[model samples]
Target: MKNIIITGTSRGIGYELAWQFADAGHNVLAISRKTPQTLLGNKNITCLSVDLSDETEMEKVDNFLSHSWKTVDIIIHNAGSLLLKPFSETSQEDFENIYKVNVFGVANLTRACLPYLQKGSHVVTISSMGGIQGSLKFAGLAAYSSSKGAVITLSELLAEEYKEKGVSFNVLALGAVQTEMLQEAFPGYEAPITAKEMADYIFDFALTGNKYYNGKVLQVSSTNP
Candidate 1:
């Protein structure tokens, strides 16, 4: 059983990932701004209420790791913000808010957990297809897409920096998964993939990705143009 930490577990993909991992007999530490009702009674799951964008609140993760876990086998950075607006209408505050949760928050949490990450551990950050160059692009998502682009780059750089340590870092640039976030971003749109399906794939990848991948941004999309 591995010790896994997942952020943004209150709903959608993160919540499903936490459930799947715990059901598979792993020790799961779930972090989110609000606690999910479904995870309240699970023995294998420990929930931490935290706002990833808040450095002071994120310190609680360090404290939890110091007392509860010695080695982290997997860390999935899934917390993010989606700010959809035309570039010309996007406000500075919108950009900052999106970056805070999607980019800076991931950096801060990963930095805090570095000391506890053991050899052969995996770190996966969820990006978006919109962030990939030459892929299908959409308007009104400047801040969200740019933040994910930063996440992809950050994952690659960290993988290079930690190559010798045996810690693998990768990013999953996901397509439109059926979730509240997707609906909010693209109302009345139908996504081919579901959050539970994405969670299953991510759970499997987190378990074995180090064997075949590192420092790479893999796109998880099912859209055809």
Candidate 2:
């Protein structure tokens, strides 16, 4: 079974992803701010509670791989921060906070995990449909969507840099999925998909998509929400 690393695993899609991978017999390292209550006893799943924005905390990831596994087959950058405020009222600190978790965190964690990633490894950075150019845009998500957009570009650049090394990098620009983050942002709005459904798609993609794609952004959405 493949050893997989998934970030943002305390809730929503990240939580589902960890369970799905473990249930399918793949080794999973689930990282989040707080460990998932149900995943505590699973042998196939290891939970790490960490602040991804901190370089010091990221060292624990290196330690885990060095002590437990030989290589990481898949790395999914799923952690994100959302700020829904009018552009006029958005502060620079707000932008920094959002970018810290959404963009910089992804970069930092990927860098730390680089040594364990082999030729066939796949790095998937989760993005948003709102981050896609020419897609529908929302006013209050200037910071959130901009950070997501930045990661897509980051993945593309990494893909080109690693092409000869045989590592693949891709971005999934997801549309609205019925996640806790979405419910908190828009209480009554119904999303076209559920977290588990999207997790299934991502689980399969992370396993085999690298064979056919590298540096590609797949926009997974049904509507503009």
Candidate 3:
């Protein structure tokens, strides 16, 4: 079984992804700000409480991985932050906070995990459809969208830089999946896909995507919007 690392596992898509991977017999290093409520006692899962945006907390994660595992097969960057407000009203602090978790956190964690990632390993970072230009732009999500955009670009550059190492990097630009974050972003709107559904797709991709894809930003959406 492969040893996998997934961030933002406390809730939503990240939590579901952790469960699916563990159930499939993979050793999952689940990281989040808090332990997932449903994953309290699973043997295949190890939970690390970490604020990915904080360097100190991420250092602990790096240390754990360094000592615990000889190799990592998949690294899924699912942890993210969102802030919704009109661009004119969005503060510098608000923008930075979003970037800290969504962009910088991914970079920091990936760097920390690089040593353990061997040949044929896959790195998947979750972006958003909102980040794509001309794709259902929402007025209040300027900061969130911009950060996700940065994630896509970063993943592309890493993919190019790491191709010779047999490491594959890709970004999944997801549409609105029903989750707390989506509810917060658009209170009355309903998403077409559920978190578990998205998790299934992601888990499958993470397992076999290196064979057919890399250096790509794929959009996962069920609706035109």
Candidate 4:
């Protein structure tokens, strides 16, 4: 019933959210670097190919938003990157790319869409527990973790700035879910949670965009661990 814009829809949480929302009867704007074959036939879903890391392409994002949707009820920034190399091994290019999407891309997209966001609109970003509290197990996550932390902080600031207008901003600090990204991050590792389950919970949690939940981190994991 809502018009939602979701980024990173090529796979993982973004793809799941796009389908879930479409199944719930909402009109979904699914943006990603490439359109997924699975979502090509959905009438209620519109897929946009976007390179979110390219800040220069923000105008394309705006044009897409303007053409496809008149009003945006939700904006879910689920696009993220992971650099799993030790700080010493991480390259400057990796840092820039991570920040480009994880930080600046979100900022630019939101700014461009704000003009269309109604008073009751919601803006959500996916964060991580690693961003919440750095884990020693996550050896090469400095760039990714800091970018996520930036997301959480940005959500808080957005909530404050838009509080008077009845718009809400929230962050979901997700734990490991069985997704391609997880597999890529920790190859050969097993996870107790699936991306579908995580997406389901996130969709439900979004229904309760109370002021208390706004500007807060909703961390989800298997068995609440």
> What's the best-to-worst order under TM-score?
2, 1, 3, 4
lDDT of 3 by residue, 98-196 (tens): 999999999998998888888899999999999887789888889999899998999999999999999999989999899988898779888899999
Please give the RMSD to the true structure for each candidate, in Å: 0.9, 0.9, 1.0, 1.7
Q: Give the lDDT ranking, best first.
A: 2, 1, 3, 4
lDDT value, candidate 1, whole model = 0.92
lDDT string, candidate 2, 128-225, tens digits: 99899988898899999999999999999999998898999999999999999999888899998999999999999999999999999999997744
Lowest summed lDDT over 10 consecutive residues: which window, candidate 2? 216-225
- Candidate 1: tens digits of C-alpha lDDT, residues 1-225: 999999989889999999999999999999999998789899999999999888888689988999989889999999888987889998899899999999999999999999998789999999999889887778888899989999999999999999999999999999989998889888999889899999999999999988999999998988762
Compute the lDDT for candidate 3.
0.91
Question: What range of 10 consecutive residues in model 4 has the weakest lDDT sum?
Answer: 130-139
**Model 4: residue 57 alpha-carbon error in angstroms:** 1.7
Off by over 4 Å in 3: none
The prediction achieving the highest lDDT against the true structure is 2
| lDDT of candidate model 2 versus the reference | 0.94
- Tell me how far the alpha carbon of residue 18 in candidate 4 is from the true structure, in angstroms, after superposition: 1.0
How does residue 36 of candidate 3 score in lDDT? Answer: 69
Task: Report residue 12 deviation for candidate 4 (angstroms).
Answer: 1.5
* lDDT minimum window of 10 residues, candidate 3: 55-64
Q: TM-score per candidate, in order? A: 0.98, 0.98, 0.97, 0.94
